[model samples]
Target: MKMKRKWTPSTRFMLIILYFEFIKETITVPCPASLHTANDVKRCPRNKLEWNARAARLNCSSINQTCVDPSLFEYHCVLNKEGNQLLEVCAPSKHIHEQKCTEFNSFGKLIQASVINCSDALITCPDAYRSTEMYKYQACYDVVYQSTRNEEAHCSSRSTEGKSHLGIAVGLNGEVKCCSGYKWSNRTRLCEKCTPGYTGPECAYSCIYPYYGEDCFKECDCQINLCDHQLGCTPVYWFNNCPHQPEYEEPAFTNTWKQRRDFR
Candidate 1:
């Protein structure tokens, strides 16, 4: 019943980036040759156009220059403790042959914030992180994967998050909760109805007899398919309110009875 912060070291909370952008950063996709923030990357003075900043990718990554190899343009995205703001994008020193990436741009007065040493999953979920907006979980995965290739190590699912939301995937929408097992649909950005053949909190249960679909919202016709037990019994001939109700009635024989009685 205790609440926990979804971030470790607190400073990592600054990296709430987009999903695609986060993936690009983790893979070290070099910045484009031309940038709105910095021009002339296409014609670098030192052939160092690969030394690009992460902020350019904060919104967009469209560019002409091919992404440089991480071996060639490795950099540490530093964070300045100056109120949890991004410090600098410092690349490998031409002198240091080893690959110990420096964090802060200057690495002199600034403290080295670690990209490792913490699992974001262990942290408490922020409003934005809980909903997966701004690629919250993916950002954590990027950092954790750097230390250990095991992606599951930093997965949010491993954490016991706001279960009180009752499996409801958070988002900007006012939707409070959803059934268990089913997550918020990335495309729709909403907790869609349970998938066909699944129902209940998180959509863990399967559709019985008739209901089917991503959320089991569809109703089945009793002809070839059986009705769902929840919909009540659908006897074989019960269509259109029993259209043949009078067909099996016994016929009256008053004329024959009268004739037979007169003869007797």
Candidate 2:
């Protein structure tokens, strides 16, 4: 018997006509060179011919050749994405020239100048470029010239003495002493001593008393002997020549009268 078949809602269906419409609409649009040429002037005889015919007649060999005569076209020009001429001409390369002027600290010394051209620019060194103070400038067609200055060396002063900080000297004991100035005191490092009348750490002040005169050369004023009588007397001198006077002055008898007769 012919039974009734069930139709499920999940069953898929194909639409060939609709798929073809979507594919055609999604394709990329091609450039219309024919329409582009119509907007240009027809004055040139070369423009009237096809690009391939013009290239063959010109005998162009390079693959990078864009046209029969590149000179006729701007060597440097700006164009839009659709191959339409936006700007007539622009800089071929975006580069500029930079110059540096250098001189030595001394005017007689020689100085060097370095220049670097990164773009289509003209660079030149000034007369002062070789001088102690150099002035360099860079220029372009329409741009202003920029100047740079520097210095070089000519004459300089150098120390002839070595790096040692000590001075040699013969000590009183015949030993070598590292002295700096008048004083032979410093045993380690070189240092200056007190001047004719000065003393102290830096020999800055004048000396007093025994240490008097220039560099404390005067003798001290202190007494030499504690006792009044002495052989070596400095300011004053005295003599005591009583040799037997000590024994005569002995206190043996208290009162000496007629001795009360030896009657005892």
* TM-score of every candidate: 0.17, 0.14
Candidate 1 C-alpha lDDT tens digits along 1-264: 999867765456456455555554343322433122221110111112212322223222332234453443333233332212222232321221122222332324222323332233444224211110112223433342233223212223211334322234332343344434355566654555554556544455454333445454554554323343344225453555544322333446877787889999
Per-residue alpha-carbon lDDT of model 2 for 193-237, expressed as tens digits?
A: 445555432443333223344445553333323111111223232
Error of 1 at 37 (Å): 16
Whole-model lDDT per candidate: 0.34, 0.27
- Please identify model 2 stretches exceeding 4 Å from their true place: 1-160, 163-193, 220-264
> On a 0 to 100 scale, what is the lDDT of residue 195 in model 2?
59
- Clash number for candidate 1: 24
RMSD of 1: 24.5
- Residue 81 CA error for candidate 1 (Å)? 12
